[model samples]
Target: MAMRKLKHKQVPVWIRLRHLPVELWTVKGLSTVASGIGRPLYPDAITRACTRLDFAHVCVMLDVSSKLPKHIIIMMPKEEGGEITCKIDVEYEWLPPKCTSCMTLGHMAKVCAFTKPSNPAIPPVSVLFLKRYLQGHHPCSRLKGWTNRERDELPHGKTKREYRRLKGWTTSERDESISCRPKRRTTKERDESVLVKEG
Candidate 1:
């Protein structure tokens, strides 16, 4: 037999119904409440046994395109004649990421292949490149701004003696052979300088 791949957009997710009325604890009531969200499958063992009163767990088949509501209003028949309204909160246990670009499941719309990036001017960074950059394994030359340590470690065509001599010299001199950028001062240093100027 030839194997065939099946793509299903509708998925069964376990949802919790909170603040349910006492009259709606039965199978029919649970089904009626869950129907508002999706196709109700069945309640959990605990829900059926009524062991836990916190919430009722039910498996609901939800479509990827369907709107996931946070709360649903239910109309309960009063003892006299008119029906009373009650609000029940719906909590999904787990839901797969859906892509709105292609109307498919598994991936989000932001990272979808069919969807174009909002800004084409800036290129997206790869996971491996970001990981290596974070780990300090990648070269800092490609980056726009460089830290003091990175600047110090950068290759300059100067001799060891000349490099050591230039290291101690803090003069603000910019030469073609040597790149001399002023060191960034901390907030405390800036505050001290401000006080000295004020005095």
Candidate 2:
């Protein structure tokens, strides 16, 4: 076993938070990001777990507004035969699961995926997003093409008037026909009625 004294620096943001509202999660080892670029000499598993990064290795400054812990610990490569464990300590905002059923995050009862009618807990919002992702159908607001109205005019969206137009229907002449006085009906019907009364 080799141990060397490394230089430690005070945290940057810690000095600023005089005490607003914070729950710190302290881990005891360096992140996999550190070792991936240069090996911390820990192991493989540690590298995989700690190096789970999103947004192109950009340090995502998590918002601490959620009612979750504000700290996290990252584990390093586990030593063979379970001897050495590299614990990475991280201090940041943790978004705790506001959901009581699954204890997950960014979800409500209406949108949890893990929830079933019988054994339901989490909201189904996650499921909805998943379905939309799989279907590859985005809302009209998100689309970039001509737009819903234009697309509707093209083929898919057909209303009564639109359907009629597709069927080659035009304005009917009968609909525009006008009523005339008929020249007082030639006065013949009136004369005939008078003769019948005389008979």
Candidate 3:
């Protein structure tokens, strides 16, 4: 049997709250603190029983696009009518892969279909391949000198024939452009050329 792929943007996640004050162990207090991360669902069995003083486990309905903060600051009212600040640490048991481009769950931003270039002239390259190529790892590193803006105008992951056809460049023009680039000279050859120039 085939099952349909479900796109889950919002999910219930179990988060551990650390450094929680003794007074905030109640249901009301736990909900208030958990609300900082997401809509508070309910606390775990241990949390409800107050059997564990180390941390409180609460299930929250979290949105994939919500910012995951390491720590959250909470203000508590003191007996003297002033407020005291408390810092709570948050820990997620697990998180699903999220796509920042589409702001959805189950996929990462790099492989996001929405981020793929719409123009057929620019063949789509994997984010990892494009990153490495830009860093001079690819054999076609000659194109490394081109800025991102310029590279956006060029066809990537295409053969020379395809590139020529896409850019409407003739063989002579392509050869001329290739020849215009400065050739790499060895250290010894460069020194000899310098000595000859000085002579």
Best by TM-score: 1
Tell me each candidate's TM-score.
0.56, 0.16, 0.55
TM-score, candidate 1, is 0.56
The list of candidate 3 runs beyond 4 A from truth reads 1-7, 117-199
Query: Model 1, range 1-199, lDDT digits (tens) per residue?
Result: 9996455689999999999998899999999999999999999999999999899999999988879999999989999999999999999999898888787888888887668766679676698766545434333222444333232332333322211112222342453132345467667665554211111
Q: What tens-digit string does per-residue lDDT give for candidate 3 at 115-136? A: 8767649587698767755554
The alpha-carbon lDDT assigned to residue 165 of candidate 1 equals 15
Error of 2 at 163 (Å): 81
| Alpha-carbon runs more than 4 Å astray in model 2 | 1-84, 100-104, 107-199
Go through the candidates in order and give each one's C-alpha lDDT: 0.74, 0.31, 0.75
Pairs in clash, predicted candidate 1? none
The CA lDDT at 125 in model 3 is 65
TM-score of 2: 0.16
TM-score of 3: 0.55
